[model samples]
Target: MDNATAKNIREGLKADCTKCFGLCCTALNIVASSDFPINKPAGIPCVNLQNDYGCQIHSHLRNKGFKGCTVFDCLGAGQVVSQVTFKGQSWRENPKIREKMFRVFPIMEQIYEMIAYTAEALSYDIPYALSDKLSAQLKEMQSLTKLDAEQLLSLDLVMYRLPLNKLLTETSKYIRESLIAKLPGTKNSKNYNHERADWIGKKLRGKDLRAINFRGAYLIAADMRNTDLRSVDFIGADLRDANLMGANLSTSMFLTQMQINSAKGDINTILPTHIERPSHWIN
Candidate 1:
């Protein structure tokens, strides 16, 4: 696929809550914690949901101890389930379909998440061979999203995701190796290992952290200004209050909306095109 097509697909996968029926608030269970004010079971409507399918405490979610809600992104799965899967019929109106809708929402969510990741991989300036493979995989994944509800439930997404994940991994490897080769010297390259390290309050300015495994690392209050973070896997990374000023993360992988929401950044923090800077970030 061309860059424009890839961009369009990525944009379409973004969450549009206005077109959804508050599926995240209902389909996913929330445990009482620092992030959530109360415990809510799966399939039960959150107490904050309004009659019109809007969050009554959306603007004040974090203030009211529901910071988890502020970071949640359904990746357009909510709308797909609300409109395409059920033909715009809500659980409230069709109580009979509520159970099925809840069951299908999570499956669609996994599909859309893969779609987002594959589309992002296709946008990278990789070799023609890799790009062609990614394009084919992207087309296949997008086709699955159009499947009927029954087909979606029966579909083996794990089978589909395995190969796509392989492609993404290879793409990340190529980008990281390329970036590392361009670094100034061996000392700089040798000093670039921060994978799963305790980096709290550590100054990591201008570091070449491409393809580093930061999954579940504690990076709270670290200085990460002007860091080259391309292809880094940030799944489950705790970035709360980490300084990301002027950091280039446009090519980062597995960096979810929730991770970005938890971090602190300034206007200069360069992020992936699909992600928006949190409003709480410094201007």
Candidate 2:
């Protein structure tokens, strides 16, 4: 019953709940913070959780330190486990089954991964030549997603990830094709097109440049730690070797996945969009 490592990476972006059962919040103990109020035990609902299964303090989570809750995405692991596998008999409505729901939560997280991968495959704009093969893989992944709770709980995920990686490689190529092509032969550099001029290779730590359009500029080896870059457009900017430790760029925009992954960030760095800083960047 080993859970297969999913071949799809797109699932990480969109966790599907139609196929999930809300297992993580229901089965796990979300630590008490100013937002959640109560440090409920495993399988027990948070005091903030209402009868409708929504957090009563949803809007005020950050004011309380439940900041962790905002970033905790089950990747659609909850809904799929509850309604899809268990036939909607889990803890969303009935409180008595909380204990059993907690036990099944982790296993359900694994099972939802398969569905996650399948969903990613469907998002592709693949070449016509590869459509048939892609369709077959998608169908096979969907079938695995329908396994019962017992079967899902016993899954071995180590072996599952290998095939998923292979499938993801193909999907990624198609996704790239779906994006609007940039201008031909344009160097991948940052352009200070906005009122903010270029600052490539500048030693500018502790400088504040919030709300600037830094598109298509070269910021190689720039020292930008502890600076404010909130609401900056980093499209086509080359931030290779830029120091972003302890920087505050909250509420920034146009920082694509590639830019964030390429640039360094630690817990000390305050990210835009309320993302939790990485551990490495912690002070």
Candidate 3:
């Protein structure tokens, strides 16, 4: 898929809270931790959820110890359930179907996430065969999202996801190997050590971080402006308040909406086409 087409598909898969019924706030359980301030059961409505399905503390979630909310993205699942499956019938309005709605919400969320990942994988400069397979699978997963509530409930999602996951793994490997081959030195490049490193508030501007494994690295408040981060894996990197101005991460590996939301960025932060800048970021 071309960049523009892929971008449009990705934008369609983004969460639009205005079109949703606060599924994440109500359907999912919130436990007491550094991420969440209170404990709420799965079927219970969050105390911060307003009557119109809006989060009262939406702008202040992180400040109120609900940082988890800021990081959570359903990838347009909420609206799919609220608008398509339920046909604009909210659980609050239709109390009889509330239980079933909650049950189906999580399932749709997983499916949408899969679709988003698959679409993102197709956007990369991958081999034609892999791209074709991913594109076909993306269409299949997208069609599944349009299924009725009963069909979605009965879907063996795991079976459908296995092949897609395998293809994505292969794509990642191919992209990483291709990137590594183009680095400054074949063997002795200065790689970013991201294993539990304390890089909080450190200045690391304009560095080449391609294919670096940043799983669970602490990059809090780090100045990462103009960094070359192609193929860099950010599986579980903590980027809270990290500055990413002018950083090119359009082809970064395993980067998610949660990570982007947790970090600070401006107009100059060049992100992947699929991911959007956090709303609270300074322009």
Across 27-115, the per-residue lDDT of candidate 1 in tens digits comes to: 99999998898999999999999989999988888899998887778788889889988899999998998888988999999888888
Candidate numbers, best lDDT first, in rank order: 3, 1, 2
lDDT of every model, 2 decimals: 0.82, 0.56, 0.83
- lDDT string for model 2 (1-283, tens) is 1012222333244455445444555677765554355676776656565655666766766576665555455655576667666678756566665566577667656544544544444444456545455555556656666777566667676566566545644554444323213323332343323523466678878976654556567776788988877645564577655788888766444344335544666677776442334332335
Total clashing pairs in model 2: 34
Per-residue CA lDDT of candidate 3, range 1-283, in tens? Answer: 7746765776677789999999998889889987888999999999999999998888888788988898888988999899999999999899987998998999999898788778777777888999889988988998988898889899999898899878877777787777777777764566544657778899989987777767568999999988988887675578887888889898787688888988888888888766878887779
Question: 2 or 3, which is superior by TM-score?
Answer: 3
Candidate 2: how large is its RMSD? 11.7
Each prediction's TM-score versus the true structure: 0.88, 0.49, 0.83
Error of 3 at 193 (Å): 11
After superposition, the stretches of candidate 1 with alpha carbons farther than 4 Å from their true spots are 187-206, 210-226, 235-241
The prediction achieving the highest lDDT against the true structure is: 3
Q: Which is the better candidate, 1 or 3, if ranked by lDDT?
A: 3
**Candidate 2 lDDT trough over 10 residues, lowest sum:** 1-10
Best by TM-score: 1
